[model samples]
Target: MKKIILIWFFMMFSMIFSETNSIYNTKIDMKRYPNASVVTLLDRESIIFNKDNSYIIKKHIIKRILNYKGKKASSEYKIKFDKRFEKVDIINAKTVKISKSGIKEIAVDKSKNIRIIDAPSDVGLMKYAAHKMEVIAFPAVNEGDIIDIEYTIKNNKKQKISGTVNFASREAVYNKVEIINIPKDMNFNITKFNWNTKMEYMDNIAKDRKIIKFSEKFMPQILDESNIPESLKFMPTVIFTNYNNWAEYRDELLGKFIKINKSKENLQILKEIKEKVLDKLITKDMTNMKKEEIIQDFIAKHIEIKYIDNLLDFEASSPKEILTRGYGTSLDIENLFLLLLKEEGISGEIVILGSDKLVWDDVKKGIDMNRFNYAISKVTIDNKDYFVDATNEFSKLGESVIENNIGLILDTGKPEFVNVKSIEKNITRIEKSYNIKIDLNGDALINKTIYFYGINAIGEREKYKYMTPIMKQQDYQKELGMISQNAYPISKQMDVELGSPVKISYTYKYTNFASIDGDFIYFDLPYRLDMLDLFENVRKYPFELVSDILRKNNISIEYPANYKVRIAPKSLEIKEKNMLIKRDLKIGNSNGGNKIILDTVVRYNSHIYTIEEYSKLYKILEKLNYPKNAKVLLEKE
Candidate 1:
């Protein structure tokens, strides 16, 4: 009887699966997809909304492996859900090896192979909630096999239906279908993203429900290449929302936030803590800037933060609870930050952050809240705006961790879109200076110093955060060996000061630094350059250079005066709208002796380039290739 009901339910959705008796029985033309690792025979999802506002999502997928890579890719997978809000049930899953001559079923114990984890496994899911992952392993998956999976996720409580539907997968998909059965009164809005495909959609309106269906015949694999930012959003996607008006949505979120933070007992406790914090950190005569810095620093230092994803779960503990516990999620910390600023007569509000402009392409029609996964506090002081992040101890006031600096301000009085320019900070730069003294045997003593500022300093701090002193020593010793195989570090020192550059100095003995034949010598100088091969061809998606940068390289080499440079020195300079490169190489004198000096500065004015602009910038980047400039040959006079 249950099987009959299940069959009826599947037929009610009306998904055309091309009639496969069994997953392993489906035969496909492998020649149609030459480079694909696997081919998906059927991919179907049905979202059914109940009259009680709850939704049930039933998903089924079947894939056939063509090679070893396909076998590995299909061997393991996981399904995630918030246990407190929803529950997931794996109806059935199996693996079978199919050949032209015969078919064999593999018996892998499901109870032994399935593992359930209550801890958060996906960064894209809620952090503090009861999020869980159910991992399944097809231990017998082999080449020329088929793996089938089916699952149903149902919400325990009724809530608005909100999620994204992607039309493509990691491998080629032969048949993909989506059916959404929504309550007529629910009125959810659908927004498509990165949609370059032309497909007809069916919207059938009935008595108490509205069904929207779409099926795609062939979807090529989405290539996972280098330099693609927010790669998931680049696919053909459909994002559904219930709130089309930003103001209404902002008010709803704000009301929820205030409700969570406005308990009488908690507010009283917060007031007392505020008084103590004010007395300890601020004076009556302090400037606003100083006060802002002190308050933000206190929050960042005192509250341990757990990061979250694009959508707010609203299930975390209140601000006062986290304040007393000395730990909190990002929302708790940011709320506390805003409350402290409010007590100081400063106004601040929480703003949801989007990764880049592409994610917010439908801002005019409707903003898909799913695109925004993180939130930060925006404060107003002296008629100027400051975006403060309480989750990162490395950033100062008005500094954001957002690489693109785009978000929506949740201002109740006048809610609006906010795009700020916080991309490049002057402190985020790298400067390196090298001094080398070569002996008659071509062995050189190299002294190098590097200064890291801004985001560069943050990166260095993070790299060394988990390392011990001995580990750092060993790492730096190995770092100098990149110059020559026989390099040995003589001395090294690193200094990290707050609000200053991270300085590193090292002196190494690089044996056989140059090839010498008694008359002629050849060597490549030590320099740093980021090669531009990611965008050698035109791409539909952009190649993301996440941050603007400035690099300065100064090299001074002292060699035998009897040897003359065989190659004539030349300076090359190229400037464009996005980048600039300047290289100067000349022969100088050191105490009447000969010294070779090279000063190069490369500056990137912008962080991102479109396909058309990337074509132009590719030519500019090609000119900065330092191979020709680094190679030097010297001959006896």
Candidate 2:
């Protein structure tokens, strides 16, 4: 009996499928109730198969147009089916009907092989209603069978209106499906779109309003053995306008302005202002004071900067306001400085730049614009160029602010291209000497003096913020100990200080080196320490090729008294071009005591060397650690 009932249901569905070409129009009235109203329209779709295992889809579109507008809206709808069947189901029909005070729902049966029409709530029903009519058809296969689908849309309204009917089906099985032999007054638009053929790849389509069509051949998984029987799933996306247009729209809404350059006139005004400002600030009576000194003093006394505020409207304030406020952001100070320099007859341009820490390799490709962050000023003095950033309180006048490296400079007067020059790594060297007396009782008294000189000193001081208190002390001790292995005996009497190039001088005493094994006197020669250890284990990766490194060191040793040396005396000499190490020792006695002297130096031209070159240089230093004369022996009576 069940089989008979199923067969009868299939026959009835097939009959409806044969009439798939029938089109229906629906009108929705939204004013039936005080709060809301509704109306529904239904349609049938089918796929007809031939004996040759080929099939075609016949789409019948029924639209339920809703005209609704109110402070609040409500409605309910229901749809019924005689029997359930596979490949013949509602695309969007689910859930039981409910009051639409908010969004309600409609229910669908699960026993039917309907792929869609299972709306959990009223929102789904409304979405089904809003969908265009052309997407209502089912895909067809090569096998001979008829598919019948019925669906309805409801809207709460009383208005009377008419809507056009349209239908769509896959072109793979059915080459073309359209409303043929229609009236000439009907208007329509046909557009072609493309889809990604790759499987498992998410393709984002519909960034703009366009319909995409996919071929069955493009999706092999959806095809059957003969490549004729299969099902394809396509996403239904609508055509929407571009969203980026709103940015330009907002700009246009605000207003536009043209920039005019009065170069000659502006230059004269700038020159007059510079002279007046400098004359009042600089104490030098003569016009020929050193530029570095004048700029340094001016920056130290006048330039005041405050943390930038989001609400700050001006990009730059006037020089008078900057001086009065004593604080501004990079943009504010740089612009003000440029104005002052221009007033002083100096040709300066504002350069836009990315912060030093911000890498620009990819950003230069122009994917996005937010990569840029900081700015500075470039001044040409007597044909010499100098870059300045007044934003940094500690930065010197001629010093390139570390954060402003490689930043793009925007020139308002003339858009001339300006490049930021790279900074050379700072190298410092300290040399020290110790004089002491060693008695037969294995007791020694020592006095030590040290001298520091290099760019490394300034770099170390600049990095003080990154070091903990204990780490800083340890670092300082390690640095001082480099002059001599017995650094604990040395007390730092004077701290490091900066002058033109920066210098540090200190003195200390050691009482621990009094014990000796021989009656005559003996001492092990200090090993030569290479500054190249600073570059150890650094070039482990390919991307570290261009990073720069700084190296600095100080060494000191006391001359032994009444000493017998078996190895030759050792000495190292480092100059701008090459480094040389030589060791030779001989036993000797002096008026004060036995004396032994060891010297070594590893001279490098500059700290700025590429990773490849640095690796090569490091190899040379590694060779200096040869086991030659690593140990020395002395005799005593």
Candidate 3:
């Protein structure tokens, strides 16, 4: 009788789940995405808004694991939100394992393996916002198991923010379903981002409420690439907004700032900062540009910018609080910088900004004020405008991080979209000079001097300024491993000054720098030209070059006595509209030995390239990276 009941129960279970295209009945084919360790069988999210400005969101996710690596999908679950406006509740969760003989199920137990963390996991965050996260781990998870998660978030207050739902993840999904319900009379708009395929959607009127559903099937995973903008900017997503438009949003944001700027406490703090920090920087002989540079440098270095917020504090930090504490969130830092500039007689306004990736095709298609997650100050000088962000410690007076290029100026009360290009035209330049002395045994002593300009200088200065000499040497050893295995730094020096390119000079020795074959000797070229070729993989999506870069390398090699160069690669030069690469090799006589001087230069003019462009660049790289062609041969006289 017991066996009969067990069999009947499973039969009923299978029958109920075996409906057409139901997630519980779906079977993932392991061969479909061979590189993928797991697949999302279903991801459904539903939002129901009430008449009282509160809403409830239900999320259901089902994933099928294919291997041990796939277990990460079920190993842990985390949901983060602002505690002031949202509350999360786990409805029910379970994991099922099916084998040839039978099936086993395990349900989540909130009494064990669950934790609530109040602080952000990111170490860089310094804001004291009331943010919280609930984390849970599924039990009895293993390879080839299917995990299902169900949860709901209830809104506690009126919705001041828009919503965006992403259908793509690191794992492929067979089906994705999203639904939203609102009052029939509410005005709203939905925008699509990075959408490649069409989705089936339906609008229905159910009594006094309106319902919309969107469904898509067989969506592949978005491959992660370095240097590219984040997934939020380009992934397949649905953006729903009920706040009307950018103008309304900008007015509300700037209105708050204006009120704060008028506060007596805020004014006092600005006056104090000007007296203590700005007065010393202003010299009668200094130009306006110099004073601006000094003011920006002092704040960026002295005032720390961290992402610190609490659950109850969702608003941007007040200027007075930020100035008093000497540390604040990135937004706070930018707001404070704007106020400081105002005190210095510089006329500027805060500009809302978006990532460059968000403006790939056009700004209108993906335009959503919610996408503008950054703030910077823009000042016009002599009819020219300059944008800067104090949040970025290395940012210069007229330059900011490249990602924050697409901007909307909030100055005139009416927001106007602007393409905020860098005023610093020559952004990054690297110059490296090496003097090499080679012995008959093929060992070499090298004295190298490296110079960095613009962004490159700022980056190198920030990286080494705080590091100990021993730590810095250890870092160089790892970085130099590509050039020589036995490279060791002998002496090092750094020259960092305001308004000048940073220079790092060091001397190093390399054992067995050249290979010898009987009477013949060979030396490897010391410079690497193509930075993009380092990845070696052709990405499915567009790769970001980020910025214009110029790299120059000069090597002076003095070989041992009585040694003459037998062979050398032909000098090469290639130039295109977007890039330039050149290699020059000159041989001369020095100190009774053969002297070789090699110079290589590579310049990139653009920040983005299509896959087709990258393919062409790769072809050029093949010609430049030809190992046999890069060798310098030497023979006894």
Candidate 4:
């Protein structure tokens, strides 16, 4: 009887908020995105900028659940806000379930389910300003239910930062609308990107403000597939900013940094610090490379760099304060190094850049300053430019921690942008050598050595520098297990230095790595340079490779004295548009036994290719995928 009464109470309570709202009255066409489990029924955003420069933003989102994946969408909702700059309030939220019988509505109980938690609000780190997010989980939502959410965010601190609203998402969008109301006195530039659907724009004159609106419907989903270009490059987006050009944005940042340096007290403080560094870390006879090594090591060890968000904490802290704290942000650490270099009589400047995959296109099309999300130091030694960042403890001198080898250098004095190249030859190469010995009983002992150069060396050093011996052994065994079973490590060694390639060597014993059938033995080759196997299907866009990839492999194998070469692939050399692959396999005699040797080299000369070139490349990859094996006959001669 109590259970029945509880169910009755829920049924009656759900009816309390059953009054139909205009948003819920809208219908959904399920046939549009048949494969989509959850469909965005409606997405609306409205922004109002008053004469006082304050901003008021309201957002409404409605989603329909079609299957199990859609049910995950109905589970909860969260809205984040920075307490110092913004306030968020949920105006209305509810879930509706429709079936053949009728429609059931359930209102979210804000007082009961909604709770605030301390979370990172945005990508910026402003610790003094506490950030929080309100998370609320819906009650009793099932498949086929529709969720409706509405909230408003008001910016109390009005700054000159531009606002960007992106209308495209991975999920299918049925309708999206954005409305902006600004006073006539305000000046703003509107830019749009990657818009496929037709957009309707309208301008209306209000008594106190000018209203601009943009609306679009039936927007298709943006698919994110493997090996495809970044979604941002193809996603539809609109941005509003008061600044007109990159020069204006550059000046603003320059002013902020210049103001910090102009203080007489700050200048004296930097001078004293630089004097200390020069006295302790630099010598008159030391080369630039040596000086850089010492200074980079000192900063990386002594100063703890914290990268919380894009905005570095050093932007606010004084040099003295940062040193005293023993912890600085990316900007702070770089700035300190710049000042130290200046005192040492070396000239350098900050290079502000964006992700290579994101910034170059925009920089050519009027320069979107917002794309510049990172900063590094660019210095000249012997008339050649080098980029460096001291933020990473594991990075060697003259290497950028960000690893994006492309961006724009901020010519501080001229307020101009200069392209910075991440020299291709500086980033990739691999050399692998394998030695294998197979016993008559099919057991084998294999030794492998890998040498990584340039960026690859840096990456490998960072990956394994902190791992324990046992952890490293486990990881090594996991990779080996993919080709053979019962892989036992006999020995392992690693050699790392600042100026040379990293070398990793290991020896393993495999119980049954080779198969013995009748009077023959067979084993698969290690590290085949086959490009076709890496890509199963051709892509719409040309495939990209790590620029300047160079790989070489040398393999030596020995078999029983009774064995002789029965079948082996002939040596082949193929060179085509930007790629070269050559293999030389030889059979010879050593100590009255059969010895087989394989040496191969694979080189990719270019970083990117056009579809026409890729089509030709694809055909070559298909040929490379064919199996080539060596079979040794065990019959005595």
Task: Arrange candidates by TM-score, descending.
Answer: 3, 1, 4, 2
Model 1 C-alpha lDDT per residue in residues 244-353, reported as the tens digit of each score? 45666566556656666678876886788778777687888887777777888788778777665524455546767777778766666787788877777888878777
Output the number of the TM-score-best candidate. Answer: 3
Clash count, one per candidate: 3, 71, 14, 0
Give lDDT tens digits, candidate 2, residues 405-524.
Answer: 454545333223344542332223445544554555544455544443333343534655346767756766776577456545345443444443344444444433444564543443
TM-score, every prediction: 0.83, 0.43, 0.84, 0.82
Query: Candidate 4's residue-wise lDDT over 443-545, tens digit each?
Result: 8788888887767767877888778878776777776677566777777633333344678777888887667888777766665664722463555554555
TM-score of 2: 0.43
Ranking by lDDT: 3, 1, 4, 2
- Evaluated against the true structure, the overall lDDT of model 3 is 0.72
Instruction: Quote the positional error of residue 177 for candidate 2 in Å.
Output: 37
lDDT against the true structure, per candidate, is: 0.72, 0.38, 0.72, 0.69
Per-residue lDDT, model 2, residue 297, is 50
lDDT of 4 at 142: 85
Indicate the residue-level lDDT of 230 in model 1: 51
Residue-pair clashes, model 1: 3
In candidate 1, residue 615 scores what lDDT? 73
Number of backbone clashes in candidate 3: 14
Q: Show the lowest summed lDDT stretch of 10 residues, model 1.
A: 419-428
Q: What is the lDDT, from 0 to 100, of the residue 18 in candidate 2?
A: 54
